[model samples]
Target: MSSHQPPRPVRFGILGCASIARKLARAMLLAPGAAVAAVGSRSEEKARLFAADNGLDVATTRLHGTYEAVLDDPDVDVVYLPLPTSLHVRWATAAAARGKHLLLEKPTALCAADLDAILAACDAAGVQFMDSTMWMHHPRTAKMRELVDDKDAIGDIKVINSVFCFRANEDFLQNDIRVKPDLDALGALGDVGWYCIRAILWAVDYELPKTVIALRDPVKNQSGVLLACGATLYWADGKTATFSCSFLTNLTMDITLVGTNGTLHVTDFVIPYEEKSAEFSVASKSNFAQLHIGWDPLPSKHVVTTDLPQEALMVQELARLVQNIRDAGGKPEGKWPAITRKTQVVLDAVKTSIDKGSEPVEIAN
Candidate 1:
């Protein structure tokens, strides 16, 4: 038998009892290099119930009555923060200052500046920081990126279109935290637009757009929160992208990229229909068949299989980074935070454009 020691598991302390946190807790358990060390919420009973409902071992998972207690746990090497966008800057900075590696949820902060502050703390503490964009960890995403980068396959991208929408029931519109201005604030834009914006940026290799213009006549609730919105991004090289996100439409998720020589299409871009496998279609060239009945070259479908869910892979990757820092004294990886900042910058610009009556807003950096 080979004598290979398993890597040390990174201890994770979850900061909230949010619905999403249950999924993340499951992910942490699934990841080989991660473990749920503790869970915290305002109500001790709620924390206990979360652990019990999520099938976390009560003996192994400590339940804390307060978030601060979890952060203060010396056994917890990382903090998985699933708090609201508004509370990100505060709790994230605090966790970083406490020298805990951070795995933050999407829309890392209310704005880029707030994210920068959290990053600054992580830098000072020499702790790893990563946003929870699970799709980025999917094997299919890397395969798609490889195809897009190949000049012979896709050539230079000219346009990209992304749409993500889901119909919310009446109760959700009235009671969901996502629709509350004080909680999520950004509503549909932050809830769904984030994935579209990230996909657009990823297609362009994270290049900041030259200008952002919000689509006119955004639908907002009475409290002034966006329920539906869209935006257009323009690059200096004539490449353009458009995206629409809404909470008022039927379920749909798509990303279409058109290049000089080829096109890429994926219907389930944000969340795959199946957790174990995903597929994307790509067409390199086009030719008319005899009588122009059908194209000679048809788009080919590529499917990727994974033993674990993408969220689990995301946790494993974050745990690996944290282990590097803890075991080898390695500096935090900058790529994750850099891409996150870029996504947030573009999102901020889109919001600014919307507030300015859909005027074109120049993105700074």
Candidate 2:
């Protein structure tokens, strides 16, 4: 005879009913060992509407009128913060002070200083801090990591190029919070370039770039928010990376990595075209065989499949960690916050380079 029980689901409280929260709320439903504790918005009615619209169980999930109520809720083990960039530091720090683990959204702060405050609070509170960079949790990303780390597969990486862009309608261009200076001030750079930067760093094993220089002639909106931009990153050992992002192009998410012995390509790095399977190609030591016609060996396609969506995987990972802390008395994991900080630091360098008229900004160790 055997007896065992399933782990208790970690309760999640969502702060700010941003549109992205709907997807995350669904993800929590799919993730193992996770449950919705509450959801909050500026208005209780709005929060109720979000819950009902998203098919959240209103009978079980509490809806709070103000963000503060969710933070103060005794049952919330963690908070999923999807607020604007400018409000991240304030709400995130407060959540930590109240002993809530944090799963913050991307563009975590307006700047590195603000992020530091949030991090400090989390560290002091002995709580986990993870950013909602869902792509990082995908199974395909793990396969790619294995290949990139294998010296036999892709020798020394030399260069990386990435782009993530999407065309916005007039309404989004004019009224979207992403285009608002007081909200997501970094605009396209914060929204889209964030993925590109994270991909580059992941490819390079989270090594901070030595310097970053913004490309010339970035486009900006009337409100002085970036609409399109590009930046180049340089490493001390001569490794280089370039990325561009925009709100004025067709939907595209791509990454191309060139190494000493091979090249790697992924068309949809941020969000896979299909949820069940994702693919990437690699060409190892490809060379001309005949009279300058074609390469000797064609690139090989690798596919990774998963049952749960990447966002759900993200939620599952957070929930697992929360359970460890609650049931087994384990300390919070530091890996996520560390990588997120590196991403933010590189992002800040890119912003600084742009502000300095495309001048190179050095990244401190």
Question: TM-score of predicted model 1?
Answer: 0.98
Candidate 2: where is the Cα deviation over 4 Å? 1-3
The residue pairs that clash in candidate 2, if any, are: none
lDDT of 1 by residue, 240-319 (tens): 99999999999888999999889999999788999999999999887788999999799899999999999999999999
Tens-digit lDDT track of model 2 for 1-365: 12387877899999998989999999988998999989999999998999999889988899999999999999999999999999999899999999999999999988888899999999999999999999999999999899899888899999999999999999999999999999999999999999999999999999999999999999999998999999999999999999999999999999999999889999998999999899999999899979979988989999999999999999999999888988889998989888988989999999988988999999989
Task: State residue 317's C-alpha deviation in candidate 2, in Å.
Answer: 0.6
Model 2 lDDT, full chain set: 0.94
Scored by CA lDDT, what does every candidate get?
0.93, 0.94
C-alpha lDDT (0 to 100) for residue 307 of candidate 1:
92
Instruction: Return the lDDT, model 1, position 300.
Output: 92
**Full-model lDDT, candidate 1:** 0.93
Cα RMSDs of all predictions? 1.5, 1.4
